[model samples]
Target: MKAAHAAWRGLEPVHGMIYFVPEARRRYAELGLSGRAGYFTSRSAAFGRASVELVVSTFYNFNPDLVRRALDGAWDVTTPQHVLDARYAAADEALRRAGLHELPALDEVVALTRRAAESACEHAQGRALFAAHAALPWPQEPVLRLWHAQTLLREFRGDGHVACLLSEGVGGLEALILHAATGEVPVDFLKASRAWPEVEWADAQQRLRERGLLDGDSLSADGVALRRHIEDRTDRLALPAYAALGDAGCERLAELASAFGRAVVRAGLLKPG
Candidate 1:
């Protein structure tokens, strides 16, 4: 479990840097996408002009209105292939800027992560986002391939996490509120980013309090226990993907990926939280 968490922590920045880098925004701007449209469109483009409801269902935790605003008529302006190409191009430029290409043992990290991602593909029965990405052709370049591999793994884990949330009867906004209660992310940040109304946020908080999972803005003992259970279940669901690496391989991947992820953070490619 520790290895799984560590590996994800290391790889998260590797895959997540694309969203925060200027290169991604520039590419999206070239296609006339502004504000948060690039983010919503680029991530969901694999679904080929996906519906608002579909994005809401798969993204799980964003306000549906926000999803609709970003996705509506986005495909009319750009094709999914073009969006995917731009996304890959942004990742390529971002990685190059981070100097990940010059890192030691780059091939080994790529190979290990790719092996795990492929293994994840085999268990994609309930992983919509991962399965969508798995159907795409592999990138030929090592750096981009590394990004794609981590992207797959991230989405694989994300889909499983969504399932855990659903199984626990936690809705999209409730999940954000719970996460905020954990003190890892600010409630304001989650609320603003997800475009949830203040009233809805308050209502969700009240609901959580009624259920004994929250006390005011913080988690009660029951809340802490439930959050732990959700995360533990999510980790267990994500384990099959990393099982291909074995414990030793996972630890090695974690070590290598942590160095690379740190380099990316040092390069200022990732946004400050």
Candidate 2:
């Protein structure tokens, strides 16, 4: 932000036009840290040396001692040190198996230990996890949809490339054309472009045609203009019924709506685009 503000100093002639860009919001959403009242405190900006070091320190300070005291014996500061060391030695061996030659630092080992303990606790309590995302929050579906839209909007802002935006959010071919509008028109977007099934191909094509989204099989020129216009005019949030909001303090609504839209998508609750 400081660098951006500095760069915009001389452009103050257009500084009035220096509104908050939409892409800024997507990054926060991807990290599960966008909303006002939600986020993990211990990990958020809880710095040590390197980020990996923080995890180790957190394990050494909290979970390691807790585990040893609760199961093995009474714990002093050094009580869990052996467990931490042994755990990391196993990890170092595992990494070695995967062709990663270097050993973990003491801090990294401790951090890895902490993560394993934390994950075990979560697992014991019955929680779903995706590989390493043991602590990712699942916002409401509507909230996730809004966040997903924000992510798309963010990707659309730079060089107008729309692949990531479309690939991540689009459920079918119609949304694909809409995504293509955010950038150069893609020539073969709808023709087996994504991992589409042969079964869904004819139906998707027919739907695109019936919805007036394509010229025969390709997106029409008006479709292109509409995409660009939509990208520039409204956020990809595609928020439902903000009309009730009227124009009364719309700015705050847009900001919240952007965040909410992102949450909706992140929650895997989005309606078809």
Candidate 3:
């Protein structure tokens, strides 16, 4: 189970960097998607003209208004296939620019990650976003295929995380507040990007404080325990996908994937933390 978490951390940038890289923004601009519209469209293109509500539900954070602004007429400007094509092209370019293609054991890590991703496909019954993405035809290039694999694993875990948050009665804004409390992500970044108003953010924080899960801006002891439980549950939920690899395979994948992820960071493909 620990290996599952470690593997996710290592490979996350493979999929996540696409959101920040200039290659992606350039492609989206060519498609007439301005600002963050490309992000919401490209990621949700697997749904093929998904409703704003559906995206808001599946994304499970981000202001509904923001999502609506980004997605309302996005499909009108471009087809899902076009958006998907651009997304893969951007991912390929970004990964190549990061020199991930030059990394040692590239093929081995792709095979390992794809195996885990395929294993995840078998459990896609209740995971909407993951299932939607899993339905797409696999990319032919090794680098894009690797990015696709990590994207699958990411959505697989994300859908499960949403389930965990739902079960805990945490609303979208509250979830962001909780995540911010951990200090792994900045409060301002989340608030600004998600487009949650300051008043709403404050109200959510007050709600969490009322529930004893927050003490001012940080997690209280009880809050820490709840966060821990949620994360542990999410990790456990993600374990079955990694199980197909066995402990040794998972560890090896993590080792190689982390190196690739680090290369991406060093190449400045991802934002500085």
Q: List the RMSD of every prediction in angstroms.
A: 1.2, 20.7, 1.2
Q: Which stretches of candidate 2 lie over 4 Å from their true place?
A: 1-172, 177-193, 234-273
Assess each prediction's global lDDT (C-alpha) against the native. 0.91, 0.30, 0.91
Total clashes for model 1:
0
* TM-score per model over all chains: 0.98, 0.25, 0.98
For residues 225-271, write the lDDT of model 1, one tens digit per residue: 99999989999999998999999999898888788889899989978
Q: Estimate the TM-score for candidate 2.
A: 0.25
| Candidate 1: stretches off by over 4 Å | none
In candidate 2, residue 20 scores what lDDT? 24
lDDT of 3 by residue, 21-104 (tens): 999899999999998899999999999888889999998989998998888678888888899999999999989999988887
Model 3, position 168, has a per-residue lDDT of: 96
lDDT of 2 by residue, 89-181 (tens): 332332233222321222332222233233233322211111122233322332222222222222122212233234434333445545543
Which consecutive 10 residues in model 3 have the weakest lDDT in total?
264-273
lDDT, candidate 2, at 165: 30
